[model samples]
Target: MAYTGETIDVDATLQRLNKAASERGFDCFSLVEQDGTVVPYFTRAAKTESAPRIYLLAGMHGDEPASPLSVLDLLENDLLGMGVDWTIFPMLNPAGFRINQRENHQGVDLNREYKAPTTKEVKAHVEVIEQSEPWDLALIIHEDWESEGYYLYDLPTELTDGWAPRIIEAVSRVCPIDLSDSIDEMSAKGGIIAPRLEDIDTEPKLMGHWPEPIFMHAEGKIRGTYTFESPSSFDFTTRIQAHNAAILASVELLLGSKR
Candidate 1:
């Protein structure tokens, strides 16, 4: 599952995001530096304070270039519809991307550190989560090096039904959904893996660390969490498009629900 694909331009990508976010009236800033790479956060309020708020995150794994690229594509093109608040972490692991590894230079996987964060990056991210309002939805972008195609991990509340199915339909337009019976060694039905809450807390595979989605569930940080996984072995364009399609679909669904 070693990702031997393209590596993103950390500096260039972030630069583009900063501009795009600013033009869209977003407030942007950075709070952490990992391995000499600055980590930035961008947030834009909804058309009204009562509108749904979406928290969008990408690029926690350095090898997942399409995660950040997908975010950049959406932001630059302004494809993300209006009326919903946006909180974005375009690239959480720039150092990892700079080195083309899953973890940062210190050998820390930022995703797992969210349960009990030790690294400054995760620590800062935890603060951001705690201080923010409960988001209507949080989309965590990722790519799977071993995946046959696109798949997703759904951690939805009682109210989050109907979204996963809609997301699948949207992704199907761009790439093949990995309909495997098992994904990431977890039971999957229709390209969706809904890990049991008990398993997340007790699973041996996690080694007692919380992925960002897990931490969100445990802390009640967001109402709905969908972690999109694109196939890294596939063509880069498809991977990027798949992630883009997934995210835009989520945004569209959220806005439509409010109407």
Candidate 2:
């Protein structure tokens, strides 16, 4: 089925993101050009060397409109407060977002382009990652249309213990949790899917397809990562709230650890 949900006004959204990033003292850069539109990314450094480096990404799937909206809401409210270095990729697939499709205009699923990175968007995103220092935690906000409640895919490392529960608890206040034992064909427990590290290591690197988390893990560039999935079947507001709560919870946990 085709995506008939509310579509994003890409130009207006970019303008708002640019303004917000500028006001928040973030350095904004154009990652790539797609159909004459420049995909933008933003970064804010920490005040101290001990501060945790966090990265938040959204809007990889154009059909999932709430992911990006939630990020913008957080930025507008200055939720990325002091004490942490942040890198944000607000929207990764502008061409797909322009038409409310999952894949880009060229029919490429940007999320799966990380391994091969034939698309300019993924290539440019990879460039940014290579240029920056490793991140302490990375959150990729997304939506699952077939899900009945919120779920998350956790890429565990030493720093990730007890985080999924915190995120689930926080999001539960705003949205229901996907209690299924299996999500996306993988075993899960209480809406949290913590895959074995060895499984990730032995996973085949299929050509032209690697999710962002997989790519980051394979490159050994991030200490931990979580992919939050809000059910798109629910109201848009609920989805946004769930995403925001999950993201904020992640930040709080990471920051609290440093204290």
TM-score of each: 0.97, 0.95
TM-score, structure 2 vs. true: 0.95
TM-score of 1: 0.97
How much lDDT does each candidate structure score? 0.88, 0.88
**Poorest 10 consecutive residues by lDDT, candidate 2:** 200-209
Q: Spell out the clash pairs found in candidate 2.
A: none
lDDT tens readout by residue for model 1, 47-118: 775989889999999899999999988988888767888899999999898889999878898888876789
lDDT of 2 by residue, 54-127 (tens): 99999898899898899899889888877899999998887888888899999988887887788888888998
For model 2, what is the error of residue 15's alpha carbon versus the real structure, in angstroms, after optimal superposition? 1.0
Q: Top TM-score: which candidate number?
A: 1
